[model samples]
Target: MNATDRLTELFMRFPGIGPKQAKRFVYFLLREHFHFKEQLINALQELKHTGKQCERCYSFFGDKNLKNPKSKCHICLNENRDEKILMIVEKELDLDAIEKTGSYNGQYFILGGVLPPLTEKPSELIRVRELVARIYDDITNDSLEEIIFALPVTDYGDVTKEYLEKTLGQIVGMKNIKMSTLARGLSSGLELEYVDRDTFKSALERRQ
Candidate 1:
């Protein structure tokens, strides 16, 4: 394959990007000046060198966020964050979007991915084991009071939520930990990756 075709294929691997979009991206890049192309290459190289997955929340953080002594991201190491509540989001981007709102002051967990309905191995689709472990540790510390489902409003998101609720219910039994979700402002097919501040705040405030 030519360089353009190879680049298009790589772009197609990005989530939600298809052939047409991938080709468009490659063409756009080809049209851009050499300086812009060099900048993109340098930026990607920097990301490769600096990116680090947060051990606690599984969010993608970088060196700047590693000032803490622990092998954790800045959010996980922040003492002022609410340890009593945890918001579980579908991916790193969703978590970042929530953080950008500056509305939530609680902890977070990135589920990695969502499960489709009736999947035989739901665990393979998300970080279920890690999630359980985190909850247990929280309970042991006597700080866990609630878990909020900040997943998307789509079918896959619904399936994942049901699975988490059923699986985690056993671990949370008699623990008095409240479980909630983003409320009112969300539309039926809303995706947390693109949630607006006002909409997210309303849903968070009205979460049952």
Candidate 2:
């Protein structure tokens, strides 16, 4: 177990990275200049100390947010953004994708993960309890008008959507908040994280 094997194992821990890909990452790092490796190490160290998960959306941020330990992410604090609409995405990457489109002007809530069909103990699988509380608070504030489901177009996505809609509907129904999802403009199995700007825009417009 040398540095190469140790680094490979660490890289393999990242989601979707397999043995071959992780090994390639190690070899690529070895081929790069020492300066690049140093920079990478420094960035990781800074993030380790300063990285903060948003209190509202759970999206990770760093820098100034670390200065105020109780502060929310920039998006959550932005007054110009629409408070009446909330988009629920499965992960941070998916939320990032929507932001890059530059068409959305609403709040976001990251559900953390999608659930597979017939999964047991579903609350343990994602941030279900947290989402309910968030929605309840928003509704209480009279700031929430709609909730958009921006989950991926997959089996896991469908299951998660069904579960959330039913569970959240209880609160939404009493509050009269409309719930919608991204339209079928998204191809089957398409991930919101990978959706292109134009495609996402279309889906958003066609959302029903």
Highest lDDT, which number? 2
The TM-score of candidate 1 is: 0.87
CA shift at 96, candidate 2, in angstroms? 0.9
lDDT tens per residue, model 1, 1-208: 8999999999999989999999999999999999999999998988887788778898876764435555678899899999999999998888888989899999999999999889999888899999999999999999999999998888898899999999999777769899998884546655677888898888899998
Q: At residue 127, what lDDT does model 2 achieve?
A: 97
Model 2 misplaced regions, further than 4 Å: none
The TM-score, computed over Cα atoms with residue i paired to residue i, of candidate 2 is 0.94
Instruction: Please report the candidate that would top TM-score against the real structure.
Output: 2
Candidate 2 per-residue lDDT over residues 3-113, each given as its tens digit: 999999999999999999999999999999999999999999998988888889999988544557574888998999999999999999998998998979999999889
